[model samples]
Target: MDKIVLKNMAFYGYHGNLESEKSQGQRFFVDVEIKTDLTKPGQTDVLEDSINYVEVYDMVASIMTGESCNLLEHVGALIADSLYQHFQGIIGLSVAVRKPSVPIAGVLDYVEVVTTRGQI
Candidate 1:
C-alpha cells in the first residue's frame, strides 16, 4: 500500500467541551493519511489516474471549518468517514485532529484524537 499524507493542516473552529470554547473558537490541526495502491499513478504519471490531493485538502477544510464538535475523536471520525465514502480508491483512512489550545492546567503541545477506518 502507498500513503498520501496531509500533515498539520490548520483551521479555526469551535471544538471543545467548554462553553467559552464554543463561542470563542481556537486553532485546530489535522493530519490525514490515505492508504491505497499507487502503482498505476506512479507508472502513468497522470493526475486522473491518482487521487486528487487538492480535493482531499478541500474536503478536510470543509470538515474542520464547517461543523462544531465537542471532541477531537468525533472530528477525526467524520474526516475518515467522509474520505472513505467520497473516494473509491482509498482502502484505508486515518485522521488525527489536534486541539493545540486546549484548556489544560499544565503545559502541552496539543491534545489530539486519532481515528482509523477500513479493512485491516
Candidate 2:
C-alpha cells in the first residue's frame, strides 16, 4: 500500500462551540492521509492513475466554506466520506481538523478532531 498525504491545509470558517467563535470566525488546519493500493498507479506512472491532490484541496476548500456544520468532528468525517466516495482505491484514511482560534480563556494553540475511514 502507498500513502497519499496532504498536510497543513489551512482554512478559515465558523466552526465552534462558543458564540464569539461562530460570529467572529477562526482558522482551521487540516492533515489528511489516504492509504490505498498503489500497484496500478506505480506501474502506470500517470497522474490520472493516482490521486490528484489539487482536486482534493478544491474539494476540502469547497466544503469548509459551503455549509453550516457545527462540529469539527462532523466536518472531518465529511471529508473522509467524500474521499472514499470520490476517489477510488482508497482503503483507509486519517483526517485531522484543528481549530486554532477557539474562544477559551486560557492560552492554547487549538482544538482538533481526528477521524478515520474504512479503518480497522
Candidate 3:
C-alpha cells in the first residue's frame, strides 16, 4: 500500500461544545492520510490515474466550513466518511482534527482528535 498525506490544511469553523465556540468560531487544522495503491499513477504519470489533490482539498474545505459540529471527533468522522464515499481507490484513511483555541483552564498548545476508517 502507498500513501497520500495532506497536512495542516487550516479552516475557520464553528465546532465545539461551548456556546461561545459555536458562535464565535475558531481555527481548525485538518490532516489527512490516504492509503492507496500508487502503482498506477506512478506508472502512468497522469492525473486521472491517481486521486485528485484539489478535489480532496475542496471536499475537506466544504465540510469544515459548512456545518457546525459539537466535537472534533465528529468532524474527523465526517471527513473520513466523505473521503471513503468520494474516492473508491482508497484502501483506508485517517483524519486528524485540531483545535488550537480550546477553553481549557490550563495553557496548552491545542487539542486534536483522530479518526480512522477502513483498513487504516
| Per-residue lDDT of candidate 2, residues 1-120 (tens digit) | 688899999988877767776777878899989898778888999888988889888888877776757889899988989988999878899999998776679998888899998862
Q: How accurate is candidate 2 locally (lDDT)?
A: 0.84
The residue-by-residue lDDT of candidate 3 on 31-119, one tens digit each, is 99999999999999999999997899999999999889998989999999999999979999999999999999999889999999989
Please give the TM-score that candidate 3 achieves against the real structure. Answer: 0.97
Can you write out model 1's per-residue Cα lDDT over 1-120, one digit (the tens) per residue?
798999999999998889999899999999888998899999999988888989999999998898788888888888899889988788888898888897889999998899999853
Maximum-lDDT candidate: 3
How many residue pairs clash (N, CA or C atoms closer than 3 angstroms) in each of the candidate models, in the order given? 0, 0, 0
Clashing pairs in 3: none
Error of 3 at 88 (Å): 1.2
Q: Pick the candidate with the highest TM-score.
A: 3
For model 1, give the 10-residue run with minimal summed lDDT. 111-120
Candidate 2 vs candidate 3: the TM-score winner is: 3
| Ranking of models by lDDT | 3, 1, 2
